[model samples]
Target: MCERNHPMKCFLATLLVAICGLFLHPATAAEDPAALLRAADRWRVSDDSLQVETRVQVLGRDGAVEKERLYTVFVQSGHRSLVLMRSPAEAGQRVLMLGDDFWLLMPGSQRPLRITPLQKLLGDASTGDIATLSWAEDYAGTLVGEESCEGQPCWHLQLRATRAGVSYQRIELWLGKARREPLRAELYVQSDKLAKQARFVLDRPEAPTTVAEMVLRDELGTHKETRVRYLSRTPKRVPEAWMNPMFLARNPPLE
Candidate 1:
């Protein structure tokens, strides 16, 4: 696995720039794409551990809800996460991601199954969607130009994968000019086909920087959509053993 997490030193400096508007000014901000990506990474939740409830909704061509599921998510500092399905049809199904690796544990499975991040989770959401705030580590970003997103001035960032085994080979991101929050993103395959378009909804009153919901719309067909919402967020300590696939197979039920 590549270096998937930035050091705490960068986190402090980025937080300073994010909170004080020190680097918000276009002129003062670093023009390098990599630096801009680091700045963007600061907008994510960086607590030591985070627990949240996620709800995913799938909409059909006519804008009717086709399916919905709730999930409980646990995230650690080192890009490690566990997602447990809460709905009946998919209950006891869990996905664990450690660094760049992923595993899927289903009910009655003898062992945990390894999976890739590019696999579709639900609707327009991919397995990579669970960890949406990893661009700083996975991609090399370049500032393409200035654009308007959601009627607000924003920076258009073009990102290419730095290492292998990433969900999308390339991505285009838009962030608010003043706040540096992600406004929109376009995911693309290696063939340059637009796979999905995502909009970040940062409306969490408790955690202003954390994106509360992500709206993903399919680029093909009738433009089906999926919305993943973060219902609650709390900081806690997660044990390392819990992230192990062997431990996952042993522990069937999620508390």
Candidate 2:
């Protein structure tokens, strides 16, 4: 018979505690929020610039396709992004985001128009949702609890916007335990009103934590949905000048 304090029993107990520790707060309770946000952000970009193309589809309440758009996106460091519409009707339209400033340049317009990040681009997806930005820099996070998402263990976190002019006032994020990837998120407006929910889609279970696709749904009446699929991700050099709002008017050529 095995004794309670036997060496094998002691080893098993210690191993159990270590296994459970991985699911609990990895960092200290006070620092878990910020640490998790940073960890998630590391897997998001992990580079100076990310050049990718996206195919965006908007669907109505009844699940019929409403509209489709394509874009070439240049996501740079310092929370800056430039989006150039590739569709025929909106080919020349470009959107630039620099820090808290957002601007849109239409085909025939001489000057760029000021826009908000929260403005809906298609279905339930906002302009901010499309741009790749650092959540750790924009929001303050607090660990809420542990929850299961899509049959996987996730760390539920509540993030509040620390800066003005952010898209959502608050966001509830569910991050994967092992990979530190965001699995789901709930965006909220003022006073805890749920504006939308987003799910991160991956190609395979073993794929990189970077999002391959995103599904956004309106939490309100219509329950419209939007799908953004990542077409490609490649290393490309982006000039610093392209991030400025004035660059929209320049319409610089992309080589």
Candidate 3:
């Protein structure tokens, strides 16, 4: 063994330790993070075209209900999505996401205002949070190694947005090791500042099928909590006209 006073040996050992910390560990380095992420995506969404009923609620400091809103989200293939405000307070309000662009149409507005994905923030959740279901489509990342999350083992992954405009620029996500279920995520904005932290709740703990709710804690301003619950999901496809921004401006009955 090298003596404690051996400067050369000690310096080499210190450099090795530092290098290891900067790179992926050998044990997890071989695993494909993209494949793992795709597996995790299955637990979040399914089917190319799907209709999801979602409810967003924000809680006050005293745990009292502050605001509640319901939205019907229709997600389709080719990076297309439409979210209709289902609640009475926001009835007739619709948001459309066509590729990297987003449009918002209020109850009586004729012209659909052009908006970016980051500009459409609903409470603590962004429009993309409600519309886009698959992260593998927009994000490319590497496995960041395993860590304990809420008394369970989780695979940690660091993801960065690949598109021009999106909700979060980077995300530190955690998924259940066994089932690859999305457990938690730390969302960052374009500036790389932590915007919010989210925890996923499953419908069934044992043999879970899908994520039932997402509980978000605000880190930017209010520091309050917002709960995004998935009320239901069904297989449905909308007409081609529905994808058109002008058609949405006409406000035809979408049912």
Question: What TM-score fits each model?
Answer: 0.81, 0.82, 0.87
Compared with the true structure, what per-residue lDDT tens digits does model 1 show for residues 1-255? Answer: 223385776778777768677435553455667776777766666565878778899988787899988888887777788888899988889888887788889988859888988777787777778744568878988788778889988889999988665788899999888778888899998788999898888875445766778899888755888998878778866778888898889877668
- Per-residue accuracy of model 2 over 111-198 as CA lDDT, tens digit each: 8899999777666767787775578888999888777888988888899999866788899999988787888899898677998889
> What overall lDDT, based on C-alpha atoms, would model 1 receive against the true structure?
0.79
RMSD of each: 11.4, 5.9, 5.8
Pairs with steric clashes in candidate 2:
none
In model 3, the runs with Cα more than 4 Å from the true position are 1-30
For residues 1-255, what per-residue lDDT tens digits would candidate 3 score against the true structure? 567889899889889987886585752755678887888887768778999999999899999989999999999998999999888887788899999989988767789998877663557877878888888888997888888997889889999998965789999999887788899999999899999999999989877899999999989899999899999889889998999999889875366
**What lDDT does the true structure give each of the candidates?**
0.79, 0.80, 0.86
- Compared with the true structure, model 1 gives a TM-score of 0.81
Our model 3 lands, by Cα RMSD against the true structure, at: 5.8
**Best model per TM-score:** 3
Report the Cα lDDT for residue 151, model 2: 91
lDDT of model 1 at residue 29? 57
